[model samples]
Target: MVFSKQVESPITTEFFIDEPTRAKIEYQNGKALMARGPQALHEHVVFHMEKALGRALPQMEVRFKDVSISADITVKDEMNLML
Candidate 1:
């Protein structure tokens, strides 16, 4: 199993801005956690999940790892209601 790594040293917003990474970085409660790139298995799972969700809930939109801020997956209605 894989888990996100917590940054050891305290970091400022400036440091986070200076650092560049393709992986996602999440900051919360004075701590920073970096997410690893999705593995092949993980991608496969997410793809299938999205497909199934799209079929089952045709009226809703399904997104995976596309939110600008902090969301692994999001399913929202046409009116953009967060569920």
Candidate 2:
């Protein structure tokens, strides 16, 4: 996936999905976050993680707040919250 940011402002973040299992986050701080080859559950929890932070991050820099998981996608991935 590709990401670009503008040269101004309070900071806007956008996410994209490709290959179904890969996720990307583009932040206004000239940062691009990518998490590739995640299981279905990893995708779900990461979505929620972004949401949870979005709600409380009016004054924080979200680029540093981004989180990611491992590339391994096994049953253990689900057991570890990839589900």
Candidate 3:
């Protein structure tokens, strides 16, 4: 999901199940979710594109159901913008 072409929509806290240490997140249609798996490669690409054009997405909150860890994150290509 590439969101480096427009402004980001306001995102709020998200709820997920299980630990997300190695889990990968995919965003689409203004929705964010954590998949079960490692995302080192995906992160490598995204992190590298931090300075690229159209890469400024909105920030969202992440919470674990297992009480492991939580933090604020930005989701790319994960929001529907109006006007």
Q: Can you write out model 3's per-residue Cα lDDT over 1-83, one digit (the tens) per residue? A: 22322333455332222223434555563234324334544453444465474454346667578566689997657365555
In model 3, the runs with Cα more than 4 Å from the true position are 1-37, 54-56, 62-83
In model 2, the worst 10-residue window by lDDT is 29-38
TM-score of 2: 0.22
Per-residue CA lDDT of candidate 1, range 17-77, in tens? Answer: 1122334445463233324334533433443464577632123335578556765887777
* Candidate 2 C-alpha lDDT tens digits along 1-83: 54322222366544434334444444444223333333544544555565677642233454645677669654555557843
Give the per-residue Cα lDDT of candidate 1 at 51.
58
TM-score-better candidate, 2 vs 3: 2
In model 3, what lDDT does residue 6 have?
37
Tell me the spans in candidate 2 whose CA falls farther than 4 Å from its real position.
1-38, 55-83
Query: What TM-score does prediction 1 earn?
Result: 0.21
